[model samples]
Target chain A: MTTSRRQHTLEVLVENEPGVLARVAGLFSRRAFNIETLNVGPTEDSSISKMVIGVAVEGHSLEQVIAQLDKLVSVISIKDVTGKVKEVHDTQPDYQN
Target chain B: MAHIPTANGTAMTGATSLVKSLEAADVEVMFGLPGGAILPAYDPIFDSSIRHILVRHEQGAGHAATGYAQVTGRAGVCIATSGPGATNLVTPLMDAAMDSVPLIAITGQVPSAAIGTDAFQEADIRGITMPFTKHNYLVTDPDQIPGVIAEAFHIATTGRPGPVLVDVAKDALQKMTTFNWPTSIKLAGYNPKTTPDAQAITDAAALIAQSSKPVFYVGGGVIKANAHKELRQLVELLGAPVVTTLMARGAFPDSHPLHMGMPGMHGTVAAVTALQKADLLITLGARFDDRVTGKLSTFAPNAKILHADIDPAEIGKNRHADVAVVADVKETISALIPALKAALAKNQPDLSAWLRQMNSLKSTYPLGFDQPEDGSLSPQHVIQRIGQISGTDTIFTAGVGQHQMWASQFISYEHPRTWLNSGGAGTMGYGVPAAMGAKVGAPDATVWAIDGDGCFQMTNQELVTCALNNIPIKVAIINNESLGMVRQWQTLFYEGRYSNTNLESKRVPNFPMLAESMGCVGLSCERPEDLDKTIEKAMSINDQPVVVDFRVHRDAMVWPMVAAGTSNDEIMIARATAPDWDSQEL
Candidate 1:
């Protein structure tokens, strides 16, 4: 079967609160997006949490989705790893300085 | 000592380490009942300003919260204690689940020490509410309370926005932990956004540009997203006529020349027959429910449908949408308007011949009703009079049963969200409180709560709320004196054994007298001539709530029914020689 293929990874920063996860999932479920996996964890600082998501999609539509997701109040930042595969997007700056 | 108002606008219980955090998260009101299990969390509420609405019944509290959310377009917050109290909140949670409302249920569970041994007032609330809620969490540790509450609200209001239950042990609320609100949110499974692809919009527009005849099938989403201007622009842009789904009554002005009013089994003949002939059909925000499409296979069979909706499952669940666009109806329709305008500028097809042909089909199947010398006042006639009396912008809410179906069939809505019925859930006894909510939402406009005797009694106690609040919701009860909707089935499908469907309301507190007892002016009409005066007095009254008991035909049945479990293709219309009244099915 012929198919269009593209993939993207995004980092989301969200408030570490109760209903936040449900709200985020609610958005994806509403759009009927099929996600491969989503990993959420606390940052080095307790005030914000980080989430990494991988989604299989068609064309460059990932950018448009990421742009819209970024507009939500709970979302702090988003990075499309489809092209930035070699580097980790969300990280604490090294203390070596 | 602090008085910080919470989400529901009442002052909260006690002081909490997360007082500032809760306040920051827009904690305005919370509906809750207090108990020993909730004492720990109660401490912070007293010091904070978060408000709580102490409810008489946990179920009512949850439903009230649901009503509030439906009107405000926000998440409803409710609280309950362990075991029975927690169980009471479950019904409304499930209701919210099916209706897709945003709800946050905070229940206090037994402390961790007393769990598993069946702690007093302890039941497995988290496990019970798990399948029903969109998501739930159990806070075993005190440190997680702040983050959990914050996350719970976010999740409940986002995405498809269903209720989320949070079970907090007694110890967790009292725990002394530093609270700092998080600024950003992240989750793997949940992300909500409406992004309609430009190409699909173009594809849908191409079909419109090519078809000899096309029609715009509008639904509630046009109003939900406030897309009236865009919808009008597109229909005018493409020069096609418009028809509305039930929820979409107000998208176009009913008086507009191009507007064909509501379409379905009870829809206008023009709307129904035009769909039979159209080559391309553009649907916005409306799901082709069985009521709208009498027989699925026969509904708009010749048309290549381009369906746009915010919900994805609706696209192919019942009817297949050729070019499915999953986005907010307003966003999608707004986008279509411009694209179709561009396409029309380049090449405008001649659809006048098609329009003339559909107009002819419309003339053939005009929507009409009869009041023939039949002694009983027709319920359809009553609704048509309601349509004739109330302006197009009037808001109408119906209790479940024959009355609701009649309103859906006869009345024409000229605005969106003006006609509110429990569409997806079909909950009885929802009309009064919902109409009360509609009055709350639209105070100046005329609001009517169309009810059946059986459904009215279920939530009749709320009539006190209407009188006390002084919100004049015109209550029109189609008193057939039986469980009308169910009786219709028992009469048609079940051999006329008629077990348990009969009404003994007269033996009890007859409905009209009960209205007078509730301090609302009451009127009863059995004759056709009395109908007009009764309705006029009802509209004129502004002092309190009012009820008009129009004694309709006792055995009236809603026609054009698709029996449950039967596919949408088979419909039992209102015709004679059917139901086989002469024989016995049993």
Candidate 2:
């Protein structure tokens, strides 16, 4: 198990419903996982919402967090898109944000 | 069958719809108490087919529901009003969550407009129970009641079952709505993997094939998944020792040769030693709880872990799994059996030496208790007698403390769901009500609540519910007249200060009289000679609930102790005597 802490960005897709964010936020708080930044917005499918969560944690702890997140009935999918964005930015310079 | 207009087209109150939804879900019984906010729902329940057991307290309702669920392998239903009523359910909900009992709690809430304002009898139970429950809902719209009820039951009974709460606003219950049971439920985010990964199964099989000494550390999940049959088959196939945890007292039969007794702080010497010295730990449905593992870092230091559970988060929460299989235990064992048989065909491992060593340890330090120095009746003796007389068909429930441990130790459990307790949460008052619920679920089976004096007083009022409702459960109060477990701790670690642990039970509230007042047959026994006769008398009284108060020694403690925060290697056979681990050769 990797013990060194590193910054990881997790993109969680969830059902757009009342208290969905609270459920996600509550999981982090109850598990004592510190959230650096969290942002949520509606996706192309209006019924679905995407949440980008940033936290500095060990790889093992991050795995645990993802597993716990997967338990929520509202959460659709979770992906650690930490380095993928960087790779895409380096490969396509013409594609600007 | 022709559908009634009330089923779909005709509009009815949400409360009536709720009852219809429950009927559609096949809920035959529910335990609850009615208050102001929940009065509307109770109105419909009067005419419904479902049997509602009116409990004295909301906590009783919750635990009764849990007990019902555990024995029947169905989702138990409980109901309560908002605010204090809902808050009272917190402990039982948490207990059910920790132990993974399938339970549904339907609570009445204040009006939607009064939710944030903290109106009379208002509480945010949905938010309060968020951390503990599997899922929760706050329903304001009357139209959503039917669908939500169906969804709650589905979520509660499936994949690592736990409690689910649906708090409906009072206005919703009063409003007119059409009831329509959903043909199916589709929760997009919730899909549990029942099939084990082929590679993981192969890896586990290979590990089992090579290991000379392996132990099956079983937990409550085995019972929850109803995988005890597969568990026995796998254990026999591998020719390995099996140690059931406190939560899994009967997953493996006590009479079986491969079965070592329960393993934990107060577990048997053979079981604890097996885990401490094993080469491999095949943990099924059981997480490595601190109580079971002792000190995490030092627990089973020589063994590699192969963990399988339905809940993914439990895999590496406390101890890292060398090979983790995320699937239902029943499915895991079913798949692993064939793979392990194939692996054993190529490489047959000899386990005679390991088995011999375990049997030797088992004989050397058997589970037995000495008569108290004070000459008072022994709690162990009473409990053992109760088990012996009641026979195998009985369902035993326990409250937490020395009696709980003794019940686990002395009672010979050969079947799953025969033993129920508040294992994870260790709620003291779980026994009486849980037994009440278990009796309600299994009407023909004899149900016994082996409780401590401290624990009995907490929820003994449920006896009234039992007597009035014709749920005849027998209660055996091991009256030590003090908080026995806490007093044991005081004796061992606190220099026998005693402090506030004493309950003075003998002096205050005569148990037999109290039982009689509650419409139960109250029996009391002080001498060892009277124990069996008293138990027999209690057993004969099937018409009414029975409470047997057996006065026992207060100083008596649970043995085979590994002190809190210590290593399993440091387990003591008695008060100060450690087992001769070096002398035993594997």
Candidate 3:
């Protein structure tokens, strides 16, 4: 049975460096994951950057997405804040044509 | 804190420090080829305790390293020069990644200044290997060498083992710096969960108890986690029929009554049927690979899966798990045993009918092929005879083909790490070098490379390396004189228009002569009666490598095959009543 797609916002902390964002985006695209929206910037700690990524996934895919994201060496941590973040922040993901 | 070249307590080349760090990691053996870029790294080998095996080709180094890692459960190290050297290592690295083998590939890059200027023998080693590696590093700074090596080893060996590459620039090896080996890494992004959630375990146990037709589907993760003992316990406790994947051949003892052999595209009818009919699939460390799950939509339609794997990506990749337990397979099995026992004590599900059904399938459609009355040798028979003659502790590696499937079907692996093959990648030319590497890792174990004739031609030059190094691994080339697997496909699906599958020539290179020329014993078995003696002679010579070419039937095909994208339920067993496509008018 197909589970309804739920929109989830995840805040990912990663090392600030070249190709870090590309690595993150590459993983999502390779796995064929539907990214709703993504925003990136430097955190309070300049050495680390924070990426707020919004994606619509099934209940089963939520764990997989988080797990796959966590596998990146550049990614520091990821937290799912679906309800915590306002839905207004979500935008159409760039990769979806 | 052993310093590299502490002459007046200062100055050391980057290569010396690199060797020092590798020693710190207790790397016993390194398989590699040297070139202009990596020449500096070769200088320190004379001073270091590590044994360097110079391979004929760079690809051999990668496969040999993989073989060592598979058996030793440690990161096998291989080195290569830049450009073509690095590119050659690609197949093995990708193969290692696919199989989750722990391996570390070190490639020397062009001088820091010369990089990306189209310098001779310059390649983007790090960028080339980025997709498949667990992690990688391009170290332009000599100071980071020790830490990078440490991290590479740590990452390669831990939590779903895989290949990691460290591409060191030439200047890094030529320049001097003090060595400081980082004892631990603080990678915030790379923590692997080793413990299963308590609730997930409880849920899995409840599902296990409630289901009547349950099957324990095991894979390579059990062996990697050293959970075979726990696996056996779970099997005995539940009394459920167990089906091992191609990678999980030796993970479970096949002699046990409940063992139902392999389950997949070329698996036994009993194993394939059991999974299709199972109500619950307790998957331990095995992914639902497409080969195993033929026509995914119809695969195990009735079964609710409980997946226990350390790698979370594998959990929901193909089939959605009812309970996904992310932990080391050994630990997960250890936790599940007690919970499973508790559930059973509360109420045992009736499995007598299921057991009866399994037995009936096993007896009715047992794995077998037609034996010609003309007394020609069959590849399956050759494998069986080898199993009988060779010691119980023998390790077998096979190149991919009909021979690989035949070896899997015929060989009974009693212990973990005893059966090594390239399952996920289905890589040909893997048997020779991999067996040599396995032999190097475990010198006492009798290692045999069960290769197809076509595959043996790919990397059999490694036999020279084996013979010279005194790595006496037996190689049995199932010489069907054709690419047997593809020929079988062409025969069945492509209207028997065999396209370049036949390798026959007027003067076929004498395998025995070739082996003898390579400084090893060579033998051949043409008749069925001579098979026992030839294998016995091959097994007796333990000092150096031996190659045996067994001429078998060219037209033989693997049975109980689930054609690609076809339903598992529609497994074809007998050849007498062929499929409709074969009999169709062209």
Q: True contacts preserved, each candidate?
A: 0.00, 0.83, 0.63
Q: Which stretches of candidate 1 lie over 4 Å from their true place?
A: A1-97, B1-59, B76-82, B112-117, B120-126, B140-146, B177-179, B265-269, B288-299, B313-315, B372-374, B468-472, B516-523, B559-573, B576-586
The TM-score of candidate 1 is: 0.75
Error of 3 at B100 (Å): 0.7
Query: In model 3, which regions exceed 4 Å deviation?
Result: A1-10, A33-40, A52-63, A80-97, B1-11, B576-586
Clashing pairs in 2: none
lDDT of 1 by residue, B222-301 (tens): 65566787888778888788888666776787767787656665456567656666787788877777767766767777
The number of the candidate with the highest DockQ is: 2
Best by TM-score: 2
Instruction: Give lDDT tens digits, candidate 2, residues B1-586.
Output: 1223247655899999999888888899999999988889999899999999999999999999999999999999999999999999999999999999999999999988888996998889998999999999999999999889888988898899999999999999999997777777888998988888999999999999999999999999999999999999999999899999999998999999888899989999999999999999999999898899999889999999999999999988988888999999999999999999999999999999999999999988889999977677999999999999999889999999999999999999999999999999999999999999999899999999999999998999899999999999999999999999999999999999999999999888799999999999999999987888999999999999999999998788899999999999999988899998778995
State residue B279's C-alpha deviation in candidate 3, in Å: 0.8
> Roughly what TM-score does model 2 have, to 2 decimal places?
0.97
Which of the numbered candidates is closest to the native, going by highest lDDT? 2
Against the true structure, candidate 3 reaches a TM-score of: 0.93
In Å, residue B396's CA in model 1 sits off its true spot by 2.0
Sorting all predicted structures by lDDT, with the top scorer first, yields 2, 3, 1
Query: DockQ numbers for every candidate?
Result: 0.05, 0.79, 0.51
